[model samples]
Target: MIVVQEQDFDLQHEYAALRQDCPSIGAIVTFVGLMRDFNDGDNVKSLFLEHYAGMTENVLADIVEKAKSRWNLQAVRIIHRVGNLLPSDQIVFVGVSSAHRGDAFSACEFIMDFLKTQAPFWKREQTEQGGRWVDARRSDEDSAQRWEK
Candidate 1:
């Protein structure tokens, strides 16, 4: 599942729902990304996120499909929030369920790594210093690169 919305989500509820056993699911991996209050010594006040409506959802769905193709995952869920958000708010989430722990771990990481670079969302941060556009980190690129065939 790929959902891009401005609403906040409940991680515990989502995790419980995702972990409901079909008996075969042995592992579930989840990642929750939160907006931080500080960036490079500057105090971040808020973030303004922008994304293309249909296009962003399509790309995210494609990423999830790619992860499913690579792993024997039972379920995958991705939620990304858009619009204005404050520091310490939930920014995104990725969850993967599989019959094995290894596949669950790898696929969950793969989805988040791919989303960092491939997803079409841009963030502008409000800081005490001023507003600035956020850039994709080199570390994220490196993380995604390691998974590419």
Candidate 2:
């Protein structure tokens, strides 16, 4: 599942949903990204995100497919929020379920690594100096590269 929405989500609810209807699954891993009050040595007032909804969801599905091909995943869920957001707001969520902990953990991390680097979302950070478009980080690119064959 892939969701791009403006409303916040319930972490507990999503977690429970991931575990639902999978009696054979033994592991579920989830990650939630939150907005921080500070970034790059400045206090960030807010963040505005934008993306073509259909494109974003399609890319996410591709990332999930990659993970599934590499690992024995039973279920996958990804949710990313766009538009104006304040500090401490939940920004993204990735959940993976599998029959074993190794598959679940690796699949979850692989999805996030690809999502961060491949997703077509744009971000503008509201810093004291004014709003500025965020740039892609070398670390993120490097992280995603490690998974490549």
Candidate 3:
């Protein structure tokens, strides 16, 4: 599942719903991304997020499909928020369920790493001093590259 919305999500409810069926789902991994109060040395006030409508969802779906092709997973869920948001808000979530812990762990991390660098979401942050656009981290690219091996 892929959702881009302004509303927040319930992590526990999502996990529970994902586990409702198939006892073979032995391991479930989830990652939640939050809007931090600080960016670099600036105290963040709020964030404005913008994403390409149809294209963004298609990119995420393609990533999910890639993970599915590589692993024996039972279920996968991804949610991302767009529009104006405040500090300490939920930004994104990724969950993966599998029969084994290894696939669940690896695939979950893989999805997040790829999303961070590849997802075409633009962010402009408001801070105590001023507002500025946030750049994509090179470290995120390095993190994703690890999975290529």
Better of 1 and 3 by lDDT: 3
Ranking by TM-score: 2, 3, 1
Model 3, range 1-149, lDDT digits (tens) per residue?
Answer: 89988889999988987797888999999999999999898889999999998989989999999999899999999999998889889999999999999999989999999999888899999998888999998899999999889
The number of the candidate with the highest lDDT is: 2
* lDDT of every model, 2 decimals: 0.91, 0.93, 0.92
Clashing pairs in 2: none
RMSD of each: 1.1, 0.8, 0.9
- Name the runs in model 2 displaced over 4 angstroms: none
Best-matching candidate per TM-score? 2
Question: What tens-digit string does per-residue lDDT give for candidate 1 at 8-125?
Answer: 9999977977787679999989999999998878899999999999999898898889888988999988899999999889999898889999999999998899889988899999
Per-candidate TM-scores read 0.95, 0.97, 0.96
* Residue pairs with clashing backbones, model 1: none
lDDT of 1 at 58: 91
